[model samples]
Target: MSSPHIIVVPLPIAGHVNPLVQFSAKLVKNGMRVSFIVADYYYNRVMSAIAAEIQGEEDCHVGLQSQVKLHSIPDGLGPEDDKNDMPKLFLSTSASWPAMLEKIIQEINGSDREGKVTAMIADLHMGWALEVADKMGIKGSIFWPSSAAFLAVEFSIPNLIDQKVIDNDGVPIGRQTFQLSPSMIRMDTEHLPWNLNNDLVTRKKVFDFFFNIGRALKLTNWWLCNTSSELEPAALTLLPNLVPIGPLMTPYKKASRQHLSEEGLSCLNWLDQQPARSVIYVAFGSLTFVEYKQFQELALGLELTRKPYLWVVPSSVITSTKFSNIYPDGFNNSLRKIVGWAPQQMVLSHPTIACFVTHCGWNSIVEGLCNGVPLLCWPFVAEQFYAKTYVSDVWKIGLAFESCENGIVSGGEIKNKLEQLVSNEDMRERCSKLGEMTMKSIQGDGQSSNNISKFIQWLKE
Candidate 1:
């Protein structure tokens, strides 16, 4: 008669943690006790968010009281550590978290009721936790935050090396375009995630990261993708035991209509004033850096289109090493509104959003797809390029911009693509249909809902 207790490990990154937090909420709703494992520096922020959610929930019996808790683990970061330095932070966590996690498991085992820990769900970014759970003799599974294709690629790193497509370090060697499946679009090897980085050390680190994931994967049995079943059939089919239980966001019916911030409110007001499906929503995921030159080109393109746009360009870009004094003159005079952080799901759900101009991060792609907006993809780094290949080529729901000779997207290319996208009725119709299908798959008795339910049942068992 004891409650089921699940330990959930989340990576410090926003994209990784947010979906897992949402997944945790869903698990709590299904009557499991949950503990969110977070990095020490992020402890206060995570606890605050959880407290807000708890305080906001209705005062019903056994209402999330003692059912959720935050467990902090040291990431080996100092007060002066630059948290934004991803590679540094990751290396720090890689050295410290495993032993920290093992100790946490022992403590919970000695203190918790009936089952010390019934199961542990780890984000794919922290795949090493799966082996830790195995060492602790508990059930474990990975909640993949990226596309199934991305995971499949990681899983096949060995095969790729054997075939001479990539080396021992995972750098593509003498690479050309290749296909993983007949239905999969041929991918340009140069655009592969690892190759994009010019820094040899950084590229090697990233390359090694995937192989580390492959090693951890051998200890885990289940992978839950953040994709709808209909979206990437080939990719899901690429690996056995990969289940589609996704578009893992807040439920549409219960989502807030309120704006996230004053800036968000202003953006919402602007969106409200536009005609339905008339404004473009542009954003690159938080981690990707956009150089000033590229940013200027993007502004020019958006201005040339003469269409209303909501652009979420982080202020970090303005302060980055790539930044220059050369600003695109007079972007404010055009039909555009730029802000820092955006309430993306709410924005995509807005009636005025026509299409998304994006870097094609998995979370953004799913959010856009769920809202039925097609895409204009300009991938920057990491799994985003794979996302671009699938969305633009396999799914036929978006367009990908090719970088010009200057390694910047020309204003002309951006303008022409935006014009072509908006005017193409067939593409629009397809987007609308795909969105409808996505909506269907995540509802009652739908494929995604069923998959998630099955996974929950497995965890409970």
Candidate 2:
């Protein structure tokens, strides 16, 4: 008779946490109880966002009094840590997660609450959650905060390795292009997601760990993807237990359309004046750092495109010590007309925005797809390369830049890709259809909504 209680643990990144929060809100609306577990460093930001949303509701007094509990766990990394040191942070977090989670479980068990934690949902990248849930004897699910297409590509690494298509260094050894079945995604050696140039020991360990984790995915009770099945039928066939429930941006939908600041608001007004589907919106996700030269090239490329554009080049991206000398002459003036720190969802959803030049981070990919905007993939590192492949090759909605001997792409290449994506009507139509299907999947009678319902029902049972 009690409401089902679930504990959700998301990766520390904003992309991961945003969807988990949205999903938790939905569960709460559906007569279940939810507990959000976040890392200490991110607790303030997450809690602040939630508070702001609650206060913005029409019945402000009642909404502000509503309680959604947040639990914090130490990330094992310090508060001021640089994100670029992710490998070190990953190891620390992995080693610490089990203990942190166990302690939280013990406290929950002792609290004598009416509805106890019946299930656990963790970010897929947070693999250590499996051990914690197993030890606690709780039902466990993994939330893949990306498209099922991306997941399919990640899952196929072992097969690529077995076929000798991907070498031990995680690079494709042959000059020929490789196409993945099901999605029919094409990939070349230059675009491989894995690092081919790292020392053999480091490269081997990274690949082995990822491969083992992919195999371990089979042990989960359910898989939740931040995409709709209609958008990626091929991925659903490959992952039977997978569920798509997303766009996962309820708060954004509920918020006022007006920008929170003068600068961002001005940008939106400017965007409104552009022709429908004619502008380019460029951003690397929150954590990407680009050398000054790369940033300059991108700026120059955008200038050459001569299209109205909005770009977010974070101060961190340009100020790194190693990349300090890489800035282009008169860089600030070149991008003076564009917006900075643009509200991503608002920008993406605008009808005037035609294309995205992106780093292909998972959340950004989902946002772009939800808006039906095509991409010009320029992935930097980690999972981005896989995402790029899905956008350009798997979906037929975007294009990839040619990489050079230094593995860097130039402004000329960026300009060419932008022109191609913006001018191609077929690509635009496909992307639009994909967007409609994606929206449908997250709503009534859609596969994603049904999957969430089923997941909750199973928890109660």
Poorly placed runs, candidate 1 (over 4 Å): 40-66, 77-89, 106-115, 257-259, 321-326
| Residue-level lDDT tens digits of model 2 in 78-155 | 667664454444556777878878888788767776356778888887877876887788888888887675566567
The most accurate candidate by TM-score is 1
Expressed as tens digits, the lDDT of each residue in 356-438 for candidate 1 is: 99988899988887787889898877578888877787778888887777788899999999988877778777877887888
Question: Which candidate should be chosen as best, given lDDT against the real structure?
Answer: 1
Regions of candidate 2 where Cα sits further than 4 Å from its true position: 49-67, 78-81, 84-86, 112-115, 153-161, 166-183, 188-199, 214-219, 247-254, 257-278, 321-327, 331-340, 403-408
Q: List clashing residue pairs in candidate 1.
A: none
Model 1 residue 1 CA deviation (Å) reads: 2.0
lDDT of each: 0.77, 0.72
Error of 2 at 35 (Å): 2.0
